[model samples]
Target: MALNLNDLGIFVQAVEHGSFAAAGRRLGMPKSTISKRVAELEAMLGARLIHRTSRSFSLTDVGRDFFEHARASIIEAENAETIVRTRLGEPSGTVRLTTSVPTAQFTLAPLLDRLAARYPKLLLSLHVTDRFVDIVQEGFDIAIRSHQQPLPDSALVQRRMAAHDFYIVAAPSYLDRYGRPEKPADLAGHNAIVANAAETSWRLLAADGTLQRALVNPVMAADEPFVLLRAASSGIGITVLPTSVCATAVIDGTLERVLPEWTAGQITTTILMPHRRGQLPAVRAVVDFLLEHADAQSGVLNSLANA
Candidate 1:
């Protein structure tokens, strides 16, 4: 029997959800039915699509490539359907988005909520992490990232959402109690709640626009940005953080932006996805919403970039 589109879809889901049972649940089919479809498809192709154990399933290398190709076709079919539906003016579907914890919590989360409210049928699956995740392998529709430069992957396309403003900050209590420094060199005497150890050796642009470098030895350190921020707020030490992380606190006067006249390079926030034609309908909708909202927030980061 010829392999059917439905079976191909089942195969895609099995790879995406990582198990026959999960794929069966998503497709509203019995586990046996899902397994039978996949097995049939693999038999028709004369290649094993998955390496399966009693409890787990993983794509074979051929299966990975096949999935990429199959997903593109699936996206095209979905988009064709959407084009017809959207012409009649109704937008709906599930979009899986990923971002760092801070970006999702402080920046994208509220905007997503607003988007979801406007489009009642649209389901947004949000995955938050501080580590860089592979969107295709992870089955994510899109990702939000912050970096000093563009991602070098040719397989991925990136859209600049906004530039991020990084600030050197310390609690008022700590600065007042320990004596505020008038210059970067003076930070050597003070304690720092370090986020990145290399960040301790900070290089800043001076008032006269001269480059100034400082080698600081932090008394406290944390791998997580939030932990560093919390330590700084508790008067443990000072920290260098992005405005997205510190903006609310700065506005609330809980944490103060220190060395305002001096700052390091700006970090640009970006939206990333696999480079492909006929992208999924749901992903496109989320991307449109993000771009619109990003333009609204552009000025916030541009100021820091130009400064």
Candidate 2:
């Protein structure tokens, strides 16, 4: 029996939307028509795909398995279309990207806007969170992350974008109330706003290649870097933060660097791609745009360091 792709698509849509009526509303078709098409699809497959009721609907075991394959098929079909369009010099597809919230706010938001302006046909879906996301499992095409340690071995391809320098900073009021730390060990006496309460210790690299670890007494702790920056800016305590996040405040004198002779540590910013083979044109375009911008930013940083 030949199965209709339209019927299969309707069935998948019904499953995704959780009801025939919802899928009909989304697809702008009559609910009865949607229901009939799904029934026809199930008949062609010779299996009961969904368990239907007057009030609700659910998928059977076979339906659940079929849904997974059907979803993959739809994605492959869309990708194939996109590939063909790309070959004709028109790149149009959705690119799902994930990154840290701070990076999303401070760095990526404008770049994405520029990308949208450049590629009017491209669609971008961005996921911003603090937790580590599994790009492959989550079906994300790209991910940008900052890591202090080397990334774990994985099949994903990684490209180093830039190195993020960290600084220990405090509001001038806090530094006035509590004398600024002259050295890394002096940090133990001052209040600290840290990312992790359990791991309040920070390793600092000195100017002369010396390493110092300081265990701080946490006055405030939060997982997000922006929260730490807020607390430190509010005169709550000294906190370590990425220079990119605190540069404006530092330049404006709202925050002063503590122990300017040392750094908290450097985290490498990297962009990860799932695979090189069969990459979507949209994905390749975004990757190249980001790399170009990152290189430009790195050159500015180099010039500043030299000056």
Candidate 3:
């Protein structure tokens, strides 16, 4: 049966206000009309809700139980309305974000600081990992990732934030001791810090549209770039890394670009959301802020790509 919410609301108000006349005054209706609606509600449920009397108002055993549940529904409805109204204004509320470790460290996390300053009521929760996550299943409002190939197929709205390529970089001390590679062929003799233990081949693109390949001796290996980056900065060996991961170290002179004239491959930074339509204001605001600063976030690549 289709429940009459209006009748349910009137019934609850009648019990709370303690009299039909009082419920009518609060709801702006006649006492008889309020009493009739409550009666209709009781009849629809096939139960006695109120025991009406001239001197007092009372409830049946079933009526008391129903009243408790009905009042909760009314409060929830009011709160839902309040949330909608809040969203229409300042984009207030918590936005749950998930991102890869590198992007979170170098790109998205910094942009959120600016977002927080702009929207004081906005809150952010960040989850960082290297694995691909199911944003919908994981209850994330937004996701950011940097990748070399296309992201896996999904319904999420994917926006490319920035694009950059990998550069060979190492500490100045490493190059000073072992000397720097002046050409692709020179890498064959260099000690390389690689992502894995297996022998790795690097395909570099030269300045004049020539593709060159070289193999380097792997002195150390790690699956995570941050670890490899730290090793590279300690003068361990040359490593291929995207500029975003190494930009701060490079800027601070902890790491120096090697074979600056060649790029290994390109990578894209992208933002994903479960859906663009019907996103809460807070989620939308964060997405806009990310897209706005996407370039500035990756500007390190452009600055040093030619340097």
Candidate 4:
């Protein structure tokens, strides 16, 4: 009799979730589908694993015994996979990644090239968006997020990457036209090009380690970092953005730093995975490769080109 390991997983899921309907919901299938798979698993084993009823269900004595066995089998299978991933010389598989457009362009894009050169067998697929992504439901192997503070509680496992201060920048022409702000509060009267309308408020860290809060009027708003950079470099207004997004403009003098004595909020880049355990060798290698390229001294741009 042929047995399906997936049926075992579904059986365990049914038992743990208390009902086929619940398990199906978690697994993104129908309850009838769950029931059919469980029945097939029982047929293959030649022993019933659940006692079905109109309203509820119960496990038979044999079912009770087999549930533990099924769960153990799943765990052992996971362990075997872990062993294979860790013991392998070179990790090779397709790793699907999702992140914002800016990160994809200035960060992950170059790294993907590096990964291909370093591990020729490995494959990568990237998705770029600024919307919230359900990592599990969306089927992405990994996700990246940059935030000013710790993210809200979630089930996804997180790995901290490079952290760089948010830089408030403007074109030299803008400074010359509007005059540089002498203090954080001085920015209140200036035009502000923001990532979005919602980001009009900024918290700046002064030279003395004091916190300064300033709210600027939004003159223009764009979701993509490069768009915002282009606007800022065109003498539109001062904008506060993560250093990774502004590093290149600052280096080439397209944009000049505003309030050199103060920095905007510190932003941290994080790598998020669906689960900490049972990570594929390819996924693990991709994560480590990213961490290896994370430059603490410099965020991206020039560093990524050379590193």
Candidate 5:
């Protein structure tokens, strides 16, 4: 006997509500209808799924196993429906997204504020983290990453959003004390404030499109970008970072761009999804918004890049 989705749905609901009557109430169906569907489901499976007494109900061993699979199937079905509804209907829903802490605070968060004001029905959940997150397993609808490489293959559909350049920046006080380097090799003597030990190496592009790499040991090292920025703002040392990361500080004259000639390799921002077909309405909206936001800020970014 083939299992009916309706029957399995009823059985799952009955287990969730802990009683046929409660399930009926939740599903807006009669108690008899709920009970009958659950019975039909058990008959189709040739197993007793529920043990019912006067005032309560409990799942049998077989039911417990069935329930797990049933629940997952139901959720996938619901997610499929949501995806269809989002594509066909008004773009209104909550999109759960994540990004690195510094980028979220300085870049994406402000963009989200604009999006929220424009689309009142859209709910945005932003999770800021430095550690890697499994977007699909963690139930995130979208994730924004800023790096040259694409997301690792598993279930994710990665889209290249925008590309921006990085820069070597330092405070005016620091420049006054140590002086700015005219070339990449001059950075060897500088006390660089590095965000990560892994980031101790910097990549630059030569005039002929060649890659120039440099390794500079920092006198001050920090795990957090914001912490390193603060240290840099205090005239600590020169740091190589994305232009957007130091945009506000550079604009406000707290930090100044150093090594205007040596160019850092372009960094690309990417939008990640579990699958194209599984995208929710809010997720699509946010992704679109980010692209537009990047375009709008391109002039300022271009200046920073060329600086």
Candidate 6:
């Protein structure tokens, strides 16, 4: 017997909507028609797909399995149609994305505005948090992250956006009172406002290419970078921060780079997607936008560094 895509879709819809009546309402078909199509599908497969009552229904074991595959097939078909439609100049879909809070605030907000202006039909659902989110399990189409450590091997496609350098900073008042450090070793005696308690050391590279680690005395520690930034700015102690987050503060004279000659470390910014194949046009558009904006920001940073 030949399998019918339409019947499969109807059966899946019935399963999803919980009954033929609800599925019929959603699909703009009569309840009787919905029931008949599902029944036809079960007959073709030679299995009882659903256990029905006068007022309710439930999927049989075979129906539950079939529903999963049928739902996927329907989605694939819709995505295929969307690909053609997008090529013809109409890209419309919701793209769910996840990223760190700091990146969202300091980097992605303006870029998202630009994306909205360019793709009026494309909608974005963005989740911003400090915790690492599982994009696949969370139903996210894309994720952006900044990490100093190497990422583990994964099936997801990874794209490097930029490298962010870390800067150790202190309020001018704190420096005047505690005395400025002439070398990394001097940091050992000073009160430190660390982002992580476990990270009580700052690694620095010297002009002669020598590397050194300075163990800090932490008076305050927090997981959030903004909290550390605020603590450092309030003269609680010296703290390390990403250059991107500290750039404006440095310019505004709220904080100054402590060891202007050295960096703590470099964090790589990366974007990830589930797969390269069958990527929706909306997803592709946002990814390209992010890469372009990241490159432009990197150029600006490089120019500032030279100056």
TM-score of each: 0.77, 0.68, 0.70, 0.74, 0.69, 0.73
Which residues of candidate 4, in runs, are more than 4 Å off? 1-39, 46-75, 78-88, 198-201, 276-278, 296-307
| Local distance difference test scores for all models | 0.77, 0.81, 0.81, 0.81, 0.77, 0.82
Q: Report residue 48 deviation for candidate 3 (angstroms).
A: 28
lDDT of 5 by residue, 1-307 (tens): 6778777777777776667886786567998999888887777778898889786678889889999999778767867777787677656767778899877876786676688787788888788888897665455778888876655666578877777666788999999998887878788778888767666667777656777787676888886667878999998888866766777788789988777766676678888886632454567677888878888777787776555
- What lDDT does model 2 reach? 0.81
Segments in model 5 whose C-alpha atoms lie over 4 Å from true places: 1-90, 197-201, 215-217, 276-279
Q: Please give, for residues 195-288, the per-residue lDDT of candidate 4 as tens digits.
A: 7788777888876799978989898988778888889988999997677777778878888888877787787889998772226678888888
Residue-by-residue lDDT tens digits, candidate 6, 46-158: 89989999976888898788888887888898788877886788567788888999889777876777888888898988999888787754557899988889789998889
Model 2, residue 301: what's the lDDT? Answer: 47
**lDDT winner:** 6
For residue 228, model 2's alpha carbon misses the true position, in angstroms, by 0.3
Superposition error at 177 for model 5 (Å): 2.3
Order by TM-score, highest first:
1, 4, 6, 3, 5, 2
Q: How well does candidate 2 score on lDDT at residue 91?
A: 64
Give the C-alpha lDDT of model 3.
0.81
Q: What's the CA RMSD for each of the models?
A: 4.4, 5.8, 13.3, 5.2, 7.8, 6.2
Q: Which stretches of candidate 3 lie over 4 Å from their true place?
A: 1-89, 276-278
Return the TM-score for candidate 3, rounded to 2 decimals: 0.70
> Would you give me the overall lDDT of model 4?
0.81
Worst 10-residue lDDT window for candidate 5 reads 274-283
Selected candidate, larger TM-score, 3 vs 6 = 6
| Native-to-model Cα distance after best TM-score fit, residue 23 in candidate 3, in Å | 37
Candidate 1 lDDT, tens digit per residue, 1-307? 7658777788887876678887776667898999998888988999998999897688899999999998777767766887887887646777778888878877886686689777777888888887868676566778888888767865677888877667788899998898887888987888877766555677777657888887677888787777877888898877888777776677677887677887755688888886542176667777888888878766655554354
Stretches > 4 Å off in candidate 6: 1-43, 46-80, 87-90, 276-278
Predicted structure 2, TM vs. truth = 0.68
